[model samples]
Target: MIETVIVVLHLLVAIGLVGLVLMQQGKGAETGASFGSGASGTVFGSQGSGTFLSRLTAILATIFFLTSLGLAYYASHKASAVQEAGLPDPMLQIEQAAPEAPVSEDVPVIEEDFTPASAGEDVPAAPE
Candidate 1:
């Protein structure tokens, strides 16, 4: 349950980080805003959305990293727990379950003639 929650939070933080990055203006965008492009009219005030979005993005990134670590921990622990449980390995189970072929003494044997070809035999010519 806790792992599931962490996974969900990680996904939400990742999405939010992407959105925040996309929403923030690049350095070149400031030139247009300076010439009355109306960036000052944004909800974050006259300084524009830079500081607010940047801070939010940083926070989300931190959360994303933490959740990643948490997920890794959970995975490692789960693997260890499975090992401790003494469960049969999947490959071993498959090998054990396979049926062995029967050894029959009455099997038919194929015989082949090994005589060398005669010079008069009709051999196909090799393509040039």
Candidate 2:
């Protein structure tokens, strides 16, 4: 149950990170700044959306990394527990059996038995 929660959280953070990173503007976007774009001086100051979005992206990325490590640790621990319990692992043990050959052509094939009607009985003639 806990593992499931962690996995879900990890996926969500990963998706959010992708979206945040894509939403952010590239550094070259500031080329418009030299042309005196009004957006350079926003109420949030010069840094504006760049710093806020980058911070959020970083936080989500960190969470994604942590969750990935946690999931790996959990999987390893679970596997070790199964081993410690002395339960047989089917994947670790497999035996191959010998294959048998098909029927050889040298063997005789038998046909079904059938008997024809006797000719001694009065036979009816076909109408012309």
Candidate 3:
């Protein structure tokens, strides 16, 4: 239950991070030729957008890292628990259960003989 919540939270954070990063303008966007109307008078103030968005992004990134680590730890712990129960790995059991292919040696082969029959005699024409 807790793992599910963590996974959902991680996904939301990842989506929000992508949106925030996309909304922020690149450094090259400040040039007059890019926006055509200039970048002055924005919602986040003159220079505040970069500082605020960058900080928020950093926080989200940290959370993402933590959740990732937690997921890895949980997965490894579960795998070890499974091993301790003495249950054979499904993949190994599948490989062992598969039967080997049987060899076949009874097939008949045909060969063509190309020698001409009665080489010195004239052949008779068949009636139509």
* Local distance difference test, each candidate: 0.87, 0.85, 0.83
lDDT of 1 by residue, 21-112 (tens): 99888888878876777865678788877788889989999999999999999999988887899987677889989979989989999999
Candidate 2 lDDT over 1-128, as tens digits, reads 99999999998998899899898889899788778887856865776688898889889988998999999999999999999999877565543243457779999889877766578666776799
Task: Estimate, for each residue in 66-108, the C-alpha lDDT of model 3 and write its tens digit.
Answer: 9999888888987898899998988889999997987778866
Q: List the candidate numbers ranked by lDDT, top first.
A: 1, 2, 3
Give me the candidate number with maximum lDDT.
Answer: 1
Against the true structure, candidate 3 reaches a TM-score of 0.72
Where model 3 places Cα greater than 4 Å from the true spot, the runs are: 33-40, 107-128
Model 3 has an lDDT value of 0.83
Candidate 1 vs candidate 3, lDDT winner: 1
Residue 7 C-alpha lDDT in model 3? 92
Candidate topping TM-score: 3
- What shift in Å separates residue 115 of candidate 2 from its native position after superposition? 51
